[model samples]
Target: MDGLHAPASLALGIVPRKAPALDIASIPRFWFDNDPFKTRFFDALSLLFPEGEKFFIACVRDYRANITDPELQQQVKDFIYQEGQHGALHTAFNDRLKAQGVQVDRILAKQRTIMFDGFRGKLPKRYTLGQTAAAEHITAIMAHRFTHSDVFASAHPVARALFAWHAVEEIEHKAVAFDVLRTVAKGNWLIRAGSMLQVSVTFPLHVVLLMNHLLKLDGVLPNPQVWKDGRRWLLGAEGLLRPMLRDYLDYYRFGFHPNNHGNLAKIQRWREEFAEHGDARLATDRTLHG
Candidate 1:
């Protein structure tokens, strides 16, 4: 593969200097309108463990300093915008939990101090690029899972909408990270191999910990009913994993292309949903009886 042909992974398009606008109000409402269980799940997880957002912000900040391509820089900026919106929305959700008497500030504080403070210095450009590539690949698979599974089907309409919307964006920018990595670190098979391995290990670990934390916070950690419901929701989702990892592994096999396998039609569908019901209320009447 000609290294020059490697499209900028961070490039959203050929457009230059476009600032990313986030619909923040559209975010927390989606979370609130989603399934009560899932909302509680995400809320508890976000409040107790805020490291994911810190990691995302750190990666984006690193890319800002490291990526040279103008178009790629814009895409990275868009990504940072989306991630920042997610963090802000989740923080609000965490606040709601605290208002309801959930003590999560200490947990989040510890994570912020440990993770964000630890990564304050500049990172190696190549390693940063590789990490971004790996993260994008993992998020792409998660987007697919969100779309394909019934995990969010019975969720509150707005919650389902939020996850669906986030998934579509993930699909939209899925190639940016890989494109950037290939552009800056071409011919480095070791970096590619190492990224793939790290992704394989970390994705599952993160999910497991998130789930465990949620269960513990909900007082369902020892409940067999919770396991049964969770098992049913997760059983068929394994199929989403292999294809993503396959793509990650095969990234170097041919010319790296951005228009690879993204679901544009699905993205359009999400746009329609957003236009139709984006005005939904931030609070829902749903209860977590399930």
Candidate 2:
């Protein structure tokens, strides 16, 4: 219950709800506002989620039996369920990309080889948990920004529903990994801070590189207009990336906790929205293969 607010309690059902079906085929290549750059940008993030969330689940579940608080223990179970559902959903989405002949498998293969397999044995447990805590902060803030902003307003309905739902859950259990870290790793501030620094560099670098790779595959990387629009999409007044920069800085503050951001009202609203429309199918008409 360290970071659980009243609204977040609803997310701790102990069983993870399956994500509503998303019509991955209907999601156009440039799904975000119909802009290729923006679409590719989000695709870059999606590429990371399956593998990344798996690592996060492992980091927290490693210390599951040690969590003494009943509320937190239940939250951890929900967290694992949520993250597992995320990985499965994103995997289905990525499969659609591959069927569309997008070069996504190359990126995913690299992720498996480099991130999942390569780093699995090399990193220490404390470091891994610290990294999980730091990554959760990043995703949680991104969730807040996604929910509050109009960034996804013009996105394809399929992508919008998927992201909006994911964001809500991200906000719901935003503190689970950090709580696990606090309990298991003794909340080592130095390791936590260092992991953030590492994440700040590697996370963005990986996304940008993947975006560029996807764009290059699509023959849009060298186009001047693409970069111009992409820059504004990320850094402009209504840009999604720039505003979150401040949120990212909040992690460096001493005694930072994700609940400090406080989005209960937003969570409540989204919870209602999900309860009403959360079960919508992703792409029932089309068959997807794993």
Candidate 3:
């Protein structure tokens, strides 16, 4: 970590940057090597963010006033800003998907029904925050991979920038929900572990079902080659899931924190790259890192 960013992390936790204005207008439907499976996999995730992030903000907001730590309070404000923009930008991204004849509306309706009507606001505040924290862990793990790895090496420039930028911010406030849970839940391990267990089962199930929904739309579900390649991408050697398996399991460790990943230096480098290159950050940073 550089001199400037080290203290910020220790003192204020992760500092969320101002939300960038990303224009995904020219990004195509199958933006990654024209692969519908890959495209829909991400599209499914993106579709969840708008209302989903709003629920995250709400989860944090419920316990915000009770937080006495000034640092955590500031982090809460930044978390809202970062996640709000994420929801907005993803709404736009989903709009683009709709323009390309993707059945985003159907997917979103299903998500709202399940997330809101089925789950949100129905649980106790602590449990809700626990769920939020669990989901944040998942996103942070994914954010680290997306920004720090070559998983999206062949993705469209716009699409890659969108995820990379979102990834950095996700890393930045990755602990806010968890921290809030610790403060409010009084470090209840059962609640935390139980939440993770529930999230572990439910999240992947949703993603798989949504991915199937998306693939069916493109008539790609019947293509055996698509599943073969997707299986490799998800579970094969050098797969995204395979490398991050330990990181995912680390959540169940007795006393895990999001920063345990030790990727802050990479986050700083990306932040500097964004500062120096503006909209061209991804390309420039790739050249620098390479």
Candidate 4:
């Protein structure tokens, strides 16, 4: 538990909870705050989750037998379950993008090719697992930002409920893959740092590429105003993602553990809501109406 410092209370149970049930048939194209930049920002991420989660699961499970800590072994099982649910739910939502005429399959296909397919068997397993650890660090940081910021506040309730619920679990079990990677790598920081370097370029590039695909589909890729809004919203003075840079950089530091940057305090209320209701819709109603 050297780097696994989250309170025992935070790890109460990492179960597979329901995704917020909303009819995907009628969710408007720009569902978050009616702004193209904001809505598409999330859509871009959603587009990645299916393939991304699958890769993450396999990466960690590859080292499952190496887990020596009883607590970590159990956490690994829960992590697999959680990532499975996230993939399944996001796959269902991607269909909505397909229904909206976005050709999500194309994006997914590209991901399969470059993101995981090309490198899995070709690269050393350690680097891939390190990539998993880095990716998990990034995911956890994003989860933290969403739960603590106004970023998702105006998203349609369906999306809001889904992300908020996902965020809590991500924070809860953020260290599972990292712990697995650390044990397997024997605390060699270079493997992890080298992988982060790879992810640092590729992750954001992939998301922006997906977002561009969506914007191009909507015939808005040429809109200067869209770029302006995106800049201000994501890169400008108070961008939701801007504040997470420090946390992101922290991943490169030696002896870094996810829980060092973790906390359930801000999202504690949502944690209780999910644990109590065990239903996405149930938690969502409390989130929206509360």
RMSD (Cα, Å) for all candidates, in order, is 7.4, 5.5, 3.7, 3.6
The local lDDT score (0 to 100) that residue 190 gets in candidate 1 is: 73
- The whole-model lDDT of each prediction reads 0.52, 0.74, 0.77, 0.77
Q: Pick out the ten consecutive residues of candidate 3 with the lowest summed lDDT.
A: 3-12
- Per-prediction TM-score to the true structure, in the order listed: 0.67, 0.87, 0.89, 0.90
The stretch of ten residues in a row with the least summed lDDT in candidate 4 is 1-10
lDDT of 3: 0.77
In model 4, which residue pairs have backbone atoms overlapping below 3 Å? none
Residue runs of model 2 more than 4 Å from their true location after superposition: 1-15, 280-290
Model 3 clash tally?
Answer: 0
Of 1 and 2, the candidate ahead on TM-score is 2
Please tell me which predicted candidate would have the highest TM-score against the true structure.
4
Model 3 lDDT per residue over 183-203, tens place: 755758888899889988988
Deviation in Å, model 4, residue 20 alpha carbon:
4.6
The TM-score-based order of candidates, best leading, equals: 4, 3, 2, 1
Score residue 65 of candidate 1 by CA lDDT.
64
lDDT of 4 by residue, 196-268 (tens): 9999899989888878878888888888888787978887768877878878888888767887775556566
Candidate order by lDDT, decreasing, is: 4, 3, 2, 1
lDDT (tens digit, per residue) of candidate 2 on 102-153:
7777777788777666656788777888888999989987877776645576
Give the per-residue lDDT digits (tens) of candidate 1, residues 1-290: 22212233342332121212334334442254343345654454455324565575565565466678987787777666666555665565466556545566766665566445643344455665566566666666556545643445455554454445555566666766676667645627677667567656755555566566655665666777765665554443453244344445555555545455443443444444444545322211111111
* lDDT of candidate model 2 versus the reference: 0.74
Query: Candidate 2 clashing pairs?
Result: 21-281, 21-282, 22-282, 23-282
